[model samples]
Target: MVLVQTKIVFHVDELNKWPEVLSNVTNVLMDLAQHDDHHIQMVVVANGDGIMGYLIPSINDQISELAKTVEFHACHNSMVSHGLNSARIPSGVHIVPVGVIDLASLQDNGYRYLKP
Candidate 1:
């Protein structure tokens, strides 16, 4: 038997409102992973002010549960550039070496990209 999984990467570069992010991520989780056992692999890569979304409790709390299963990556270089630190990045998010590089590599690896 062949096992196939869907790989998706969502890139959040700007500080988007929580509604859009929550809706898209929830849709991916609810529509893809929860509804169908299609083996969904998802990631959220955030850079710039976009990282703020992960810091705020109102936003972070909403998705904290999903973080247990979903991959949430923050950009180390972006944090440095923005004068922010990883300590403020919330509990479940990880720090990638660089956000843009991470995005490029994911795309190269055949992950579909979404900007919401």
Candidate 2:
């Protein structure tokens, strides 16, 4: 049997889309759990107004739990634009220099892009 690794990058730019994005990530992880031959690498990149979601206590808690199994990225540019400093970001989430550019770089490195 051949093993396959799937890399996925999820882009979220709207605050309201956080729930949907979380749901999508949960579903993907569940689906991947059943497939023994496939390995998954997932990252959720938040930019634009979506960065505000990180400031929400409830959402941050949820994201913190999920961070154990999935990667989370916050855009530095967006954070600055929204008046958020690095200290405001959750513990496990990474801060990227630029969201769109990071997305492009991930795609170039073989990660499939998903927006919800």
What's the lDDT for all of these models?
0.81, 0.94
C-alpha displacement of 29 in model 1, angstroms? Answer: 1.5
* lDDT minimum window of 10 residues, candidate 1: 28-37
User: How close is every model to the real structure, measured as TM-score?
Assistant: 0.86, 0.95
Candidate 2 lDDT by residue in tens digits, 1-116:
89999999999999999999999998988998899999999999999999999999988988988898999999999999999999999999999999999999999999999998
On residues 42-80, what C-alpha lDDT tens digit does candidate 1 reach at each position? 888888888777767787887687887788899998888
User: Candidate 1, which segments miss by more than 4 Å at Cα?
Assistant: 1-4, 33-37
Candidate 1 clashing pairs, residues 3+ apart or interchain = none
Q: List the residue pairs that clash in candidate 2.
A: none
Off by over 4 Å in 2: none
